[model samples]
Target: MIEILSPARIERARDAGRLVGTILRTLARRTQVGTNLLEIDAWARRMIEDAGAQSCYVDYAPAFGRGPFGHWICTAVNDAVLHGKPHDLRLSSGDLLTLDLAVSLRGVAADAAISLIVGEARDAQDERMIATTEQALAAGIATAGPGARVGDLSHAIGTVLAGAGYPINLEFGGHGIGSSMHQDPHIANTGRPGRGYRLRPGMMLALEPWVMADTDQLVTDPDGWTLRSATGARAAHSEQTILITEDGAEILTLPNP
Candidate 1:
């Protein structure tokens, strides 16, 4: 279902978006070498509760996943990318971790994801992968104004990833997000411009551009939720929830302070 927010609803969305961004930034600062993935999930739960918000992922069960997610946040490390279920693994230096979070505050939902290196040791390839995703995300956001086709956003995102020599995966991408975490108008990482759904004011979209270092193929882990690169190469993902306004797109999931 596609949801368009009214002016007042947009305000509520901004609040939800800010909360998600703040929680992600807090988690990024707290995560380091020796930190357990479960601990990170616990931290996220506490933050969400303290803010009087709900986690969109906690009871989320979709066809692709095993069952209810049963977690507050997604912690994907190194080869793991999307739908990363938190496990017993402890983060180590140089590990590339992606934190994907979505929360509902006052009945509005906002989703965002960030990829960062765990500790001091920074691998060049890992850094490049992370940077490329971020760049692609920025490009996608830049093309998200009203009247812009979903394909325009996809083309902008795909240009960055392809230029960086990374393959694009269409199995999972961005989508409309509002009262729920995932909604209609699927936005791929790469596509032909001037096609697909046309943007309109008050429409919110979560544009995420993710890529594996060597392959576009993905393999589901034994856990049935975590999706990893088929080649076991490092991966990165970047995302933001944006609202299409009359003049342009407003990014709701920007970090606070």
Candidate 2:
């Protein structure tokens, strides 16, 4: 559903967004070499419950997934890109990890994701991939505002990713988000400007830009959820939920200070 949030709903969205951002930041800080994926999920669950918030992922049964997600957070590692169900694997130094989270507060939901390298054994290419996705995310968010087209955000993001020589997977991208985990106005990573759905005040969108180091193809892991790069190349993903306003957009997922 394409929901133009009411003022009251928007306030609740901010609460959801703050919780989501705080949880992601806490996870990123607590994560390190030898940390198990399941541990991350556990931390997320604890935080969500303590805040009286709801996890949008746990018990999530979407047609694309095998069944109920049955996890509190997505712990994508290395080649794994999206819907990365947390498992029992322990992370190693230099491993690229992505944490995608969604939370609901008072019935409003917000989603965001971040990719980082574990420990200090970082590779130049890995750093570049993560940085590229972050840049693309910023570009996409910058292009969003009232009266703007979804294509404008997509084009802005695509330019940064393509310019950095990364292949983008289009099967999944950003979308309008409000009362639910996902909503309308599917925003592709690449598109022509001045096309697609036009932005309006009170609308919110989750703009994510993800890319792989090599091939554009994606393979589903045996877990029936984790999406990995076809070439086993390291990948990165960056995202933020923004509110379109009269002037421009606000990054609601900006970490809680």
Alpha-carbon local distance difference test for all models: 0.94, 0.92
Every candidate's CA RMSD: 0.7, 0.8
Lowest lDDT 10-residue stretch of candidate 1: 118-127
lDDT computed for candidate 1: 0.94
Predicted candidate 2 versus true structure: per-residue lDDT over 106-209, tens digit per residue? 99889999999999857899998999999999999989999999999999999999999887778899999998989999999988999998999999999999
Model 2 spans with C-alpha error above 4 angstroms: none
| Tens-digit per-residue lDDT, 1-257, candidate 1 | 88889999999999999999999999999998999999999999999999999999989999999999999999999999999999999999999999999999999999999999988747798988999999999999988898999999999999999999999999999999988899999999999999999999999999999999999999999988999999999999999999999999999998787
Clashing pairs in 2: none
TM-score of predicted model 1? 0.99
Query: Which runs of model 1 end up more than 4 angstroms from their true locations?
Result: none
Clashing pairs in 1: none
Residue 20 in candidate 2, Cα distance off native in Å:
0.8
